[model samples]
Target: MIANVLTIAGTDPSGGAGIQADIKTMSALGAYSCSVVTAVVAQNTCGVRSFQALSPDFVAAQIDAVLEDVRIDAVKIGMIANAGIAGAVADRLTHHRARNIVLDPVMVAKSGHALLDPEAVSAVRERLVPLASVITPNLPEAAVLLDRPDDWSVPAMRAALPALMALGSDHVLLKGGHLEGEDSTDLLAGPEGTQAFRAPRITTTSDHGTGCTLSSAIAALLPHHPMPEAVARAKAYLHAALAQSDALDVGQGHGPVHHFHALWASDG
Candidate 1:
C-alpha cells in the first residue's frame, strides 16, 4: 500500500523549506503527501522578510479535513509559529490518535530568522512534544528546548539525549550538523539506547530544507519500517539529496537540496 503522509507546517514561497520541502520529500520517497499550512512565510535563502500565521481554528480545520477523509499513515509537523497553533495541532492529533508522528522542533531558519515564537515554546513542550514518536532537533533547537547553552559536541549531544527523550518522545535524533567536524554525525537515542550515523559532510550551500526533508522522509518511511531503520534510511536519503544540492539553482543565497536526486540519478 502506498503510504499517505500528512505534513503540518508553514509555507515557504521559495519552495526550499516548510510544506513545500515536506511534500517534495514525501513524493520523492514514493508516498502520497498532504499538507496543512500554519503560516504563510515570505522568505528566501537570504532570510525571512515577513510572515503571517493562520488562525488556530483554521489550522485545526485543515488538519481535520485531511484526517477525517483520508487514512493518514503518518504525520510530519514543523514550524508551528505560535503557541495557539501549536496547541491546536496537538489537540487535533490527539483527537485522531495519530500514529508515526515525527516532530521537527523548528525554531530558527538557516538564515538566522526565528520561525517559532518564544512564547510558543511551552505549548510545544506541553502539547506537541509528548505526541511525537520521534523528535528531531539540531543542537541549537535542543538547547532552546532544554533551556541551556548551545552545545554541539558529540559528548554533549550524547549526554543530552536521555533528557530530550524524557520530554515524552519514544526517540530523539539529535542532529550534529552544527558541530564543526569532518563528518556530520546524527545521534539517535531512545529506550533501546543510542546509535550514531556519520556521513562525510557534503560541502554545499544548498541545505535550505534539510530539517523539513529529513523529518518528512522519516514519516514517509515509518509505515513500512521500524524507528531505527526509518532513521537510517532517512539519513541515507538526506546525504544523497545534499550531495546533489548544487544542481538546483534556486536562490542567490543558500539553495535547496535535491529532493529527487535518486530519481534523477536513476534516469541518467
Candidate 2:
C-alpha cells in the first residue's frame, strides 16, 4: 500500500517551496500527498513579497478534517508563521498521536526572507519540537532556535548538535549547506548517537526548496524504512533532484529543483 503523507505549511505560488514543494517531494517519493495551507505567500524564486496567514482555529479545523478520515503514515510541517499556528499544529499532532513527524524549522527563505515570526520561535521550540520525530534545521535556523549567532563551520555544528537534540526531538539533522565548502555535510544526532552525511555541493541557483523537499522526502520514506535509512534515501533523492536542477527555468531568480527527475528520465 502507498504511504499517506500530509504537509502542514504555507503556500508558495511559485510552486518551488513550502506546501507545493512538500507535495511534489511526497508524490515523487511514491507517497500519496495531502496538504493544509497555513499561510498564503506571494513569492517566487527571487524573494517573498508578502504573506497572509490563516487563523489558528482554521488551521486546526483543517487538521481535524484530514485526521478524522485519513490514515496518515507521516506528516511534514513547514513555515508556521506564529505562535498561535504553531500551538494549533502541536495540539493536533499530539491529539492524533501522529507518526513519522518531520518538522522543518523553516525560519528564512533561500533569498533571506523571514518566513517565521520572531515571537513564534519559542512556541515551536517549546510546543512543537518535542512532538517531532525528526527536526531539520539549517545552520542559521539552528542558531536562531538556540538564541545565538549563526555558525556554519562543521565543528560549530557538531558542538551545537547535542544542544539541538535537547530541545526535545528524537532526532536532529543540522544542515551544513550554509557553510562555505565543496561538500555539504549534515549531522544527525539522536539517542543512537551521531551520523554524518555528506554530498558534493551542487553549484546551481535552483535550490529554492531544498529543505522542504528533503524533510518531506524523509517523511514519505519513514513508514517503510528506519530513521537512518529513511534519511539516507531522502538525501540520495535530494541529490538527484539538485543534480538535475538546471533542467527547469521557472523564474528569473533561483529556480526549483526538478522533483520528478526520475520519472522524467525514465525510458519506460
Candidate 3:
C-alpha cells in the first residue's frame, strides 16, 4: 500500500516552505499528504514579517480529526512555533500512540529569522523529542536543543549526538550543513550506530525549505524503511530537489528547492 503521510506545520503563504513544501515532497515521492496548520506566517523569499500560531485546542482538533479517519503511515513535524502547540501535539500523539514521528527541530529560517519561540524549546525537548522516531536537527538547531554554545565544532557536534539520544528518540540525525565547511555532512546517530553522508556544498541561494523537505521525505520513507536507510534516501532525494531547482524562478530572495524536479526531468 502507498504511504499516507501527515505534516503538522506552519503555512508559508509564498508556498516555498512549511505545509506547502511537505505536501510537495510527499507527492513527489508518491505518498499522499495530510496537513495540519499550526501557524500562519506572512513570509516571502526575503524573510518572515509576522506570524500567528493556531489555538492549541484547534491544533489538537486537527490531529484528532485526521487520525480518526486516516491510518497515517508517518508524521512529519515542523515550525511548531510555541509551547502551546508543542504540548498539544505531544498530548495527541501520546494518546494515539502514533508511530513514525519525524521531528525537524526548526529554529531559524534560511533568511536568519527566528522560526521557533525560545520558551517552546523545553516543550519540544520534553514533550516531543522523547516520542520522535527520529529527530533531525541542523547544527544550529541541535546546538539550541542541546544547549551547546555558539562556538561548538563538528567533533563537538558529533559527540553531542549520544547525549541527544539519551533524550529518548530512537534515532537522532545531526545535520552538519550549518557547520563551516566545504562539504555538508549529516549523521544518523542511533542505537545501530552513526551513518554519515557528505555531499559537496552546492553554492546556491535557493534553499528555503530544506529542513521541511528532508523531514517530509523521511516521513514518507518510514516504518517500511529503517532509520539509517531513510536518512540516506532522504538526503539523496533532497539533493536532487535542490539541484533541479537550481535555476527555477520563485520569490526574489532565497527560493525553494524544486520538489517536482524529478518529474520535470523524467518528462524531458
Evaluate model 1: give its lDDT: 0.93
Q: Residues 1-268, candidate 2, lDDT per residue (tens digit)?
A: 8999999999999999999999999999999998999999999988999999999999999999999999999999999999999999999989999988999998988888889999999999999999999999998899999998875689989999888988999999999998887999999888778999999999999988999999999999999998999999999999999999888879989899999999885442
> The CA-based lDDT of model 2 is what?
0.93
Please report the TM-score between candidate 1 and the true structure: 0.98
Off by over 4 Å in 1: 265-268
TM-score winner between 1 and 3, please give it.
1
lDDT score, candidate 1, position 140: 91
Q: Comparing 2 and 3 by TM-score, which wins?
A: 2
lDDT of 1 at 220: 98
Task: Estimate the TM-score of every prediction.
Answer: 0.98, 0.98, 0.97
Each prediction's whole-model lDDT (CA): 0.93, 0.93, 0.89
lDDT of 1 by residue, 153-247 (tens): 89988888878988998899999999896899999988778999999988888888899999999999999999999999999999999998877
RMSD in angstroms, all models? 1.2, 1.3, 1.3
Positional deviation of residue 139's Cα in model 3 after best superposition, in angstroms: 1.0
